[model samples]
Target: MKALDYTILTLVIIGAINWGLIGFLQFDLVRVLFGDMSILSRIVYALIGISGLYAISYFGRIGKAME
Candidate 1:
């Protein structure tokens, strides 16, 4: 994978893990790490969300890759 693809995947995985923590342990890792709704935390949240949206493009390539 290219660097951009890898980065996006990494962010998505991190986001998933963060969500898991929130669901299972009632923890907010990003908030704990970067303060509640602080600018840095907000930026991290935005990047994770954008990465998730970009990940949708992967579905389009699945068929092409299988060919």
Candidate 2:
């Protein structure tokens, strides 16, 4: 579980950095590396999305842990 959490968190951070690059510089690292709208790129995007959703549960878990 700890490994899973760390993995998801890392993915989420990567996603955030990618978004930041896209917003500020109009650059897309994933698209650049994988080609625009390619299957591989789509898979990466989906994983990032899933990770983001999984991260939503972290707040609750942290709250409970802090109690």
Candidate 3:
């Protein structure tokens, strides 16, 4: 479970950095490395999206900590 959390967090961070690069420099590291909308790239995108959604659970943890 800890490993899964770490993996998801890593993916989310990667997605965030990629978005930052795109916003700042108009660069897409994922598309450049994986091919624009290729199967692999799509998979990476999907995984990142899922990770982002799953990350919502992290807020629940934060709320608990505030108590």
lDDT of each: 0.98, 0.97, 0.97
By summed lDDT, the worst window of 10 consecutive residues in model 2 runs over 29-38
True lDDT of residue 39, candidate 3: 100
- lDDT for residue 51 in candidate 2, whole number 0-100: 99
Error of 2 at 35 (Å): 0.8
- Per-candidate TM-scores read 0.96, 0.97, 0.92
- TM-score, model 3 to reference: 0.92
Worst 10 residues of 3 by lDDT: 1-10
Candidate with best TM-score: 2
Report residue 4 deviation for candidate 1 (angstroms). 0.2
Candidate 3: misplaced stretches above 4 Å?
Answer: none
lDDT of residue 8 for candidate 1: 99
lDDT per residue for candidate 3 within 1-67, as digits (tens), equals 7899899999999999999999999999999999999999999999999999998999998899899
Candidate 1 worst ten-residue window by lDDT: 58-67
Query: What TM-score does candidate 2 get on C-alpha atoms?
Result: 0.97
Model 2 error, position 62 (Å): 0.5
